[model samples]
Target: MELNLPESRSRSIRCIVKLGGAAITCKNELEKIHDENLEIVACQLRQAMMEGSVPSKVIGMDWSKRPGSSEISCDVDDLGDQDSSEFSKFVVVHGAGSFGHFQASRSGVHKGGLEKPIVKAGFVATRISVTNLNLEIVRALAREGIPTISMSPFSCGWSTSKRDVASADLSTVAKTIDSGFVPVLHGDAVLDNILGCTILSGDVIIRHLADHLKPEYVVFLTDVLGVYDRPPSEPDAVLLKEIAVGEDGSWKVVNPVLKHTNKKVETSVAAHDTTGGMETKISEAAMIAKLGIDVYIVKAATTHSQRALNGELRDNVPVDWLGTIIKYSK
Candidate 1:
């Protein structure tokens, strides 16, 4: 796939965050949500996003830099000012977890067998399940006083060809940022030109948006502490604290030389997931890093994730922080 960058923006998007399905939901329980975890995440987001929740017409570049800034609308673009956002505007994407995974997996929806009656039924069921989850997420964020607009890929004009991104117009997403409203999108059942329909994962969505929007950084909030040397729970499993990606998208663990290539670097995928799981998440993170964007994968609701979300995870991270950082090789 080509790295097609979007038109120049005066002020680039601050950051893109992906909330893992397994991290926020009960994967073992069908359609069950982790309410307490969601509340914790919402409160964390509120402290970051809802602090200066007022709509401002930021007219000039240094408006926010000035103390006691007022609602200023500047017609001039910020020219992709790296510090312009201060994370005032951002995007959020989440996975299906136990929500739509069961129906989609049973119906074989991702394999593009929608011509069958059962497959079609599964497609409908999957969307209904995931969208219900999406609304719940939106309500949680809203309760924190964050203005959130829920967007489904199916309804947002996002389609796929051969299960790859074929048509995805994110103008509305950019417009949503311009309007100071956070856009919350989730994994969805998308129409595929080759197959009648297919599943679009949130990880893929994060990569697609990063390739186009060129955000300051990206964060993945997951269930596990971070990437491991092998499948998690293994006795000898070693956490990969940092990874560096080559220009061609190849990545290597920073300190310990990993003998296994990405092909052999194993990860566990949920049985009900139509889209790939942890493996896909890591793959997407590397691709984003190839674009020179820092990608952080940390456990949700942890102090590490809070710092990452609030733009506090800089080059000089806390010594005790435990997570995987994928960045472009120097």
Candidate 2:
């Protein structure tokens, strides 16, 4: 039940990369995988592994020891000795976009409690759909020659009545990483102590793993490039290249001076999503950032998407990075 990783493994940089459901699946279509995008990300992961280098750059106060710069710097010194024979250990968690969202929404899975008898069918349907998608993802990663092991959160994680993660058995996840296999997990319908069942988001899974694994980086690959001053759909919207987390774990826009007329920032979530969309992702990343781990939110469809997941910042700077950098600030 213990991770019991070797001292060498403990010193290696550990990363958790999340592929958002929206990034991999067409939310409007039923169980459709974005094959082209998935292939891009998979190839990137394989390339990173083959090269045996950290892909993305780490930014913010936690990493730089200094702040206020337009871009954060990477601390290569902390990246432990690079071994050509082995790749950095990573844990991947993906969302259930078109696969589970439609069914979960219909089943009231996000309601945080038991559902009516008729709604039970929705719950069953949601699980089947999500599992099917998991298989597809695993197949794709395998095709790219990435050693992947699919793990179901339902089998290992539990949540409270309020739907917060109560406990999860991550020993297997840790073991898989130690064995050099990427553990693939997804959002799932799980048994809740107070509620008969509820939806457990992949974002929540990342948070829990971060607490346990203390990964050096947590990257979220989504449909958008990164957090924007306004929704990306807005013409005036500018990407918030970097965000700082307050001492109390609140989010602070690092570059709030962008010229955008919209005072209110809106986040886009797919119509079928039962989980809070961009809002929940940002909030969770901020909390993780407060723990001194740098979090990157980037678009998975970009050429740089896979690089971001590997912890590689495009220009070795946060501003130039393709995604939003969330880090802790004083």
TM-scores across all candidates? 0.84, 0.83
In model 1, which residue pairs have backbone atoms overlapping below 3 Å? 10-78, 10-79, 10-80, 57-72, 57-73, 58-72, 58-74, 59-73, 59-74
The per-model lDDT (C-alpha) reads 0.80, 0.77
**Cα lDDT tens digits for candidate 1, 188-304:** 998998897999999989899888888888989888878887787788777788888998887788845666654456656677776887778778899999998999998898888
Off by over 4 Å in 2: 1-13, 52-85, 112-115, 259-264, 314-319
* lDDT assessment of candidate 1: 0.80
> TM-score of predicted model 1?
0.84
Please list the residue runs of candidate 1 whose C-alpha ends up more than 4 Å from where it truly belongs after superposition.
1-10, 50-87, 256-263
Worst 10 residues of 1 by lDDT: 57-66
Worst 10 residues of 2 by lDDT: 57-66
Error of 2 at 145 (Å): 0.8
